[model samples]
Target chain A: MDSRRLFSGSFSLKNIHPSVLITAVFLVAYPSFATDFFIFQIGAYSLILGTIALSLMMLAGYGGMVSLAQLTVAGLAAYLMAILGDNSMGVMGLGWPWWLTVIVSVLGAALFSTFIGAVSVRTEGIYTIMITLAVAVAFFYFVRQNYVLFNGFTGFAGVEPPTLFGVYWRDPVPFYYLSLVVAVGFFAAVSYCARSTFGLGLQAIRDNPRRMRALGYNVTLHRIVAYFFSGIVAGVGGVLLVWFNGRVSPGTVGVDVAIDILVIAVVGGMRHPIGPFLGAIAFVLLENFAIDLIDRERFNMVIGAAFLLVVLFSPDGLLGLWNRVRDRLRFRGNAQLSAERVNKDDPASSGSLEKS
Target chain B: MRNFIERHTFWAIVLLLVVVLFLWMIFAVWPDWLVEAFGRKKTFVNTLLNGVTLGGLYFLVASGFTLIFGLMRNVNLAHGSMYLLGAYIGYEVADRTGNWFLGLAVAFLAVAISGVLLQVLIFRRMANDDLRQTLVTIGISIIAADAMLAIWTGTTYQFSPPDWLFGAADLPIISVIKSSGAAVYIKYPVFRLVVLAIAVAVGIGLWIFLNRTRIGMMIRAGVNDREMLAATGVNVQLVFVLVFAIGAGLAGFAGVIGGTALSVAPGEDIRYLLASLVVVIVGGLGSITGAAVGALIIGLAEQFGLAYFPTYGVVLTFLIMVVVLAVRPQGLMGGRG
Candidate 1:
């Protein structure tokens, strides 16, 4: 392996994809060109969702653990923020400083995630889904039932984002930028970690835990630690989410929202960090405009159908679909040329091709 | 039982003590102190009975799930939708014809046919991939949930049992002796008792079908090793469809029964699905007896928790699952595989 830093297997600045740079620039310049609705609802909202989905992607994609409690963990953070910070509900607010509240909330979520991981890591593969789902549902019900702590069904509303540096962060452009920073930070961290020793070992454990155990790795510990990291990512997203919504409720952590996170992560493709954002954008767009095509209540059906199609045809999601199309195009154009060269250039396609 | 006692005398003694205490609590009139400490004897007994009866409903739903999982390694997440669908169909039939039994029969047959369709069209295409099966089922659940909402709307529907099953039946258990020297017995809903009886009958029938019958042997063999069963010239695909049909039918049957006992609505699917998932997890997968035991434990825990601690009732069920996962990841009766 090369000593140089790699971003999604790229070794140098010149090796970076043009599309990635364009997307980055476009996201940065988005607030200036777009209206507040596009800036906040479409832009920031997608980024927040994408960040949460990215945490799930990191777990399911790299760590081989499909946890449905990512949203629950995010919800916990949001709830904590509402409790610790100013709230209009006259419930559990301690009026703590924003920085302190955010830090504590993130750590609390991470610890909670770690506990969930500890409980669920005992089971393998499919059972992981069942366990995490059970936990998510349990938390949702707990929050809904407990009035003394979680304010019961109504939850906390009027949770305002702090005014920092003489600017209100919750405003459209500012919130969009805040979400973008968090999103980009998490995206970079996940991508960088994918090549790091821990990430490689995590992937190794995912592929064959028994073999990794024989090789003297603490497979359970590694997976649990991965959950902690993913929790932090989700926790930040949760804080941003509460700020974005201006409230936190039991509905925020409901099973439907949890499933939506899974759908986003899956529909984006779980293979890479960027897949989550791609998926989140598509999901957000669909969710926003679904009313135009059909009744708002039937949006779930449309998304479910789309998800089924993607799962059936391309198990890897839209990112995988793109890769396949690109590979096919390259393969067709180079039929008379060296097929081996193309294969060497893209290992993902080569492995898929061989499997087929 | 003798072998178990011989192997674990301590556990046997503990079990005996618990049983004796339970029997004493039921048979003997609670002293004043006991009554004050534990609230009303009627409430206590009712909660226990409700828990056990509710367990019957859970068993009906979960047995099918474990059966499919045991045979196909597929977790049909859309199963809840099937339950809701059956309830709606059963509700329609019963309402239109004014025959509850006919409604139950129609719901079973209709859901079974749909199950057959699913087996042929979707599952047959991806026979080996469990993940894909799970994803497909999730997608199906989403679509089915929406479609059902579109058709039935979101109103809660309750089934009206016949007059005989409508009222309560007097139980032999003594609740209290009045000052006038009359013994008052506990009265419970007759329909709930009937549900319990039906569950017991189904459990025994399933056990007999699985253990005594020849096809049961084939199913057991297939659950252990599908390729080997196929190599032995068994019509594996036919067996798959048959099991799917039966399993799906059981869920539908339970839907009608449960709808009568409880109510049918949009989100009932998720509630029952969660129940089945937790029950199966605690009971051990691919085992009928495990489902029964798990359902009993979960049902009792849920009812007791609701009675004693209403706020954290869901947590009680969840804690059982977590504890089971921690202590025995394979579940209590799950094979060592």
Candidate 2:
């Protein structure tokens, strides 16, 4: 609300939002401070997943469309990249340039998602979830069986990151930076777009599409566009995911993985752009380290537990919890606290607190 | 012909075609390819039996989900967890006491009690909110699944039914096909037939209870308009709890039967859950008749797909789900919610 004072900060959390400064610091000098290769690699993978989850958040948060097919779209992008680009696997790799492959993959993903959106957009709530989930399941099975197009269950291997400017992009630091930059760029783009008129209209439509339709907005078209944008974001993430793993397989785009994407989005904050990233970091950390704590097969229990706890207790996710604590602290410490102020400023009073 | 046409409608026509194609595929097309492995007549009979039995299993699971959803509009993703739990309980009971029937009884009671607890503790607090209830159930399902895995391990397990009820029984089937008018004895699993009978009995009982009983009237009224029913001084919470318990009990019972027929493992929960979803979606949510038709179609499609197009075994069911959702989210049974 206070644009002038919003960004003004002298090493104080009170003045400037922490994300910008933290992001900038990570962007410029992440390699020097955190030189551990595996950490960066993990960060890169998390950022890719975070970006994918962020795309889910874009639809679920703003558009009120909870799609379980975001991962499928990402998988489609990755599959296209593998098919189009050079791969060691004995499949029909068109062997196109990486940039061209990226373009085609992202575009193809958008088209595929728009089609999915067209089919599912008519339904509301649980039906939409069911339709999207069914699509994900169908895609998973289709890829697993379609030998010519998807190379069957084995999938394509050796989808390494392309070298550019005489630099091997697959290196830990470089890959991390690439993923981080992409993730941050998309995150910023979403944040900015969410504040714009189109984004406001979308949020309004999400709340009451029928009302918006009565007001003369093309509800279905707006929904299709939302899916398209979400698809682009997911497509970028997919290309990154494939490059990061150096392979594409059915396991990567599995039903469990698709559900895990929802877990990540839900465990982050479905309402905030940054929520996915927060959830992703937590998820990636547990995925990497939690294996030491238990057998690999039971790790799902941990992830599921995390997902449940977040959804049950704090549906807004970790970010929501932080905001709640911060708000309480603000009230207690700022000396502007009063019963009347509480009544006036409480989000629940104004109906901003979404009843999860 | 007029009465048939009147009752059949467009869906009936489509249903007839599907049945014809299903029979035709097995009787005509399959003989050419699979005769070498599975004799044509045997394969046809086996696939039909498999589809019908699988339909019974799906009906048991989907009916409970339909009831819950119709009443509360809550999608209980944990329904499958209850199935897995029931299977494990049955396995343990049969292993200890060696009474399969007792194991089933105990499993049903235990799961029903747990379902009641789930309704009271979690679902009740959610204020009938879809997302909240869905999320909470997902959590409980996770916890239940993990607990089951921890206790029983990841290995698939099945409890043996009574020796008399188990194994194949030869039954004479008189076919009019090929104008033979001859009777052929087919060896079909007796246990499976029993399971189907049980499913039918449950379905009939559910229907009768819903239509003829006082509680059934309340349930129908409650499902139609929860607020109005509650405002009229009926105990809606009690109905919710009973429905949840019955649904959970049915799922648990189905688990035992399904486990006996096929086997229960870590992912069985999700598989049955997916089956129930397909059933409810295709059958039209909240409608028992829809659930039955949905289950039959899915069962037949699944079994047929597995036999013929092995690569895309479950794809047919998911395809049906997607198509139905696309064409009519209301489903074949015209479920209201």
Best by TM-score: 1
Please give, as one word, the docking class of candidate 2. acceptable
When just chain B is superposed on the true chain B, each candidate scores a TM-score of 0.98, 0.89
Which portions of model 2 miss their true places by more than 4 Å?
A: A1-19, A145-148, A151-153, A291-298, A335-356, B1-39, B174-185, B335-337
Worst 10 residues of 2 chain A by lDDT: A347-356
Model 1 stretches with alpha carbons more than 4 Å out:
A1-12, A335-356
lDDT of each: 0.89, 0.82
Candidate 1 lDDT over residue span B151-196, tens digit each: 9998999897689988999999999999999999999999999999
Question: Mind giving the per-residue lDDT tens digits that candidate 2 earns over A73-121?
Answer: 9999999999999888879899998889999999999898998898888
What is candidate 1's DockQ? 0.59
Residue pairs in clash, model 2: none
**What's model 1's lDDT at B51?**
98
